[model samples]
Target: MTSLRRRLLILVAAVLLLAGLATGVVLHAAARADRANRPQSGGPAVSAGTVTLGRKGRLMFLNAATGPHRTAVASVPATDPRGGRTASGLTCARFYAAAGTGVCLQSNPGVLKQSTRALLLDSDLRTLRTFPLAGTPSRARVSPSGRFAAWTVFVSGESYSSAFFSTRTSILDTRTMRLTPSLETFSVVKDGKPYHASDINFWGVTFASDDDTFYATLNTGNRTYLARGSLSRRTVTTLAQNVECPSLSPDGTRVAFKKRVLSGAALWHEYVLDLSTLHETALAERHSVDDQAVWLDNRTVAYALPANGEVGSSDLWRVPADGTGTPRLLIAGASSPAPL
Candidate 1:
């Protein structure tokens, strides 16, 4: 070969070798970081008490006892909590609106790295304990009796190509902080494809005051509706339709949810449905709300509504659970408000 051509070939080979080495280094570093920072499982299982709720995106402190006007217990700034981003970063996203004493937070570190961890905090804003989870957590719930905890994890694989695989609901003995293996895992079914997606997600879970049967919503592609599932039986039965975010009454007789309708837009308004007759009623009718509803009690419900037409900016509102009283505003300009 000519001298110029030979030199050009040599330079190309050198560049390729360097590029491959750089790619390998990056992959190795990411894997190492995942292992180093992944959240550890096993918290001193304390007697389950009031559940806590962390608002999605922004940090919100709400006194689960005071109902919603007071200042938040503590707030986490919108930074990545994974340390790979920054020391002050918030790693949890799409946090389910927690509603007992506090909310359980789902932190997604990565799939293979360290699965999501459930961080439970108290009203004083203390770090209660980190509940290590397997797979990516899709939803979490603190039992009403404050004696148990349950969460759903979503697992994805190529075998379930058309659907996502969700592990059966993980029921935790709050006192032990360990998962009960007796309960069967629930999966989403669509067009004959089995999805590991948690049907009990984004406000999909509820527990009875007696800590017996828990209610959740499952999306089977054909329909998204409420299902009453026994904690022990691990069997689910469909109850109502067109409902999302079912918040069972403190008494476990009724449910409060966002009654969705096909508007030109993709938002659903908050509504309450009777579990007995499956009757539907609107709390804020003719109004569109994108936030989840928390039943303060059998008679009261609280949620956030966007004010000034601003997205990601909202005001907390409370209304009678019976759907009769005028909507009252509690906290203004707050993005998320969870009932204590």
Candidate 2:
């Protein structure tokens, strides 16, 4: 009977110790999150102002600096990218704008689970329409004419680095309010033969100047391909292998994309592909880029890379598209770059 009492006492002590450890972990996590929300020292000065996509000679991006304006839509003069920023009061997890239309993907906590949605914005950054999203926003784009918009979300795992994950990509015709809920329903032609697969996943859509044509990453059977899709026909055809997140050039002659360097690894090198020649030119940026690139112009491309020594922050960098010049920092504490 004495031995039984001793065992019970030991179990009680162990339970108390575990409770204390769990409390400590929760407190530490709360402290870290609090620090992230607070404004950091030497951060950029941001003030609320009107941000219009119609305003020419400007560049817009989601501000990543630690402060109240973090994740807000902010803009700087294209002539001076590092100049003072004017921020719109709106916030988003991912954003893209073209010709006067903007797509903002937002998320908020809910009673049961996290709720996500996409907001269609006008040139003045006002919400014109809202659509429910299935998961966390990954990439967003708008047609150059502002008639169409597309967004991708992670339906399963959070990051592309994960070996097993799924994504859902949607396209919207803002003019007619027509929406394609999932790209997977579209017919796929692989290597001049009709292909169908249960494991197919699509993401990182980039629209061409022509409203009917688009480019996106199509992954299936452990391989990724650059797919040229048609919105009118509801079909996509594989153009090249090992291409992810293809961004069509302004001139429409080449596509800037991230090419995976090692199989089953997240490492990637940015490359420009000539559509006519099917040739790829490796860009000068040596870092492993994980974000979909945006063309500053026909000659240059910009992308986001994780900030050095800063957690949960990213910076925008630009490199020449022809694989000539070195990579340069275009904007500090910024992501989702949109040139107006």
Candidate 3:
């Protein structure tokens, strides 16, 4: 064959190979998405039903099972977590509830950027109000009285493990509909003195029942500290270092948080801190937990861990607050455990 013809044939073959690979990739992606929307053979039974935040003796979570209900708010009897799940049509990236109020963070893709918002929900899961979010949602919490709500979002980088990132945390008063656009505007008292830094970032807010006080993770100077915040005073005081995502107990005596095990790394271990003595007790989970824990009761704390052999999913696990018992699986395909 002529040299020009030979080269032409080779180029044509290369284009065909590339076309075949592109087709395969598109097909595979479609198949994966279809599977995600269909119920799995052995997955837990889920059905559409009413989910109320005020329902007593129930446990609510974000369902992660492969089915139509995936990512929806689901509830089961706290006594029987493995029983059939009742799914609420509402979907959220992160969710938390207390009393009769709920805060749901939702994200949707946009042509120019990602659109994010926080929905204030009533007991019946109705959208009472919607607030625009600055970025992707990370953590959410409501005051035990259901009068206050808070949410955290990443303003720059997506992952907390990233070397550098910025977050915007906001608080809302449900009664008056007043909003605190950013917690950074509050005064910071680090180690009892006034503190200020250009790189300070705050996230993972957990509210106290009183509605005036809350706890959150404050990051500055390459270290993370547990900051006790007061909404009435508009101030935050650093309590301890190396603490992130602090969840207050029902009695408000202890905080369950994830402690970084190493510097400059994302690894963390679950721990409970006594507010009176400032003592820390590491839990028995052993695995790295990268979530803000929820106190199932005064004695037990639950958090989400990446599901075994599953991508983009997590399972709810609980451990004793005293740091004595082994970690037990509370829900197979769940995240964001909230007890009502």
Model 1: residues with Cα > 4 Å off, grouped in runs: 1-101, 106-116, 122-125, 132-140, 151-170, 180-203, 263-265, 307-311, 335-340
TM-score to native of every candidate shown: 0.59, 0.91, 0.91
Candidate 3 Cα lDDT to native: 0.93
**True-structure RMSD, every candidate:** 11.2, 3.5, 4.5
Top candidate when judged by lDDT against the true structure: 3
Q: For model 1, how does the per-residue alpha-carbon lDDT over 1-340 read when each residue is reduced to its tens digit?
A: 6999999999999999988887887788787555534432331111222222333343342221111221223243223211111011222433333333344545444334655676655533345667666555545566655566666555553111124444444566655656663243643333344445424332257788766677776655435667676655556666767776677787777888876576333567778887788888787545665555666557877676665643334565678888787887654434333333
lDDT of 3 by residue, 67-186 (tens): 989999999999999999999999999999988899999997543467899999999999999999999999999999999999999999998899989999999999999999999999
Sort the candidates on lDDT, descending order: 3, 2, 1
Cα lDDT of all candidates, in order? Answer: 0.53, 0.93, 0.93
Report residue 279 deviation for candidate 2 (angstroms): 0.2
Task: State the weakest 10-residue window (summed lDDT) of model 2.
Answer: 107-116
Model 2, range 1-340, lDDT digits (tens) per residue?
A: 9999999999999999998987887788777667767987887777788889999999999999887788999999999998888899998999999999999999875434788999999999999999999999999999999999999999999988898899999999999999999999999999999999999999999888888999999999989999999999999999999999889998888999999998888899999999999999999999999999999998999999999998879999999998998999999999999998
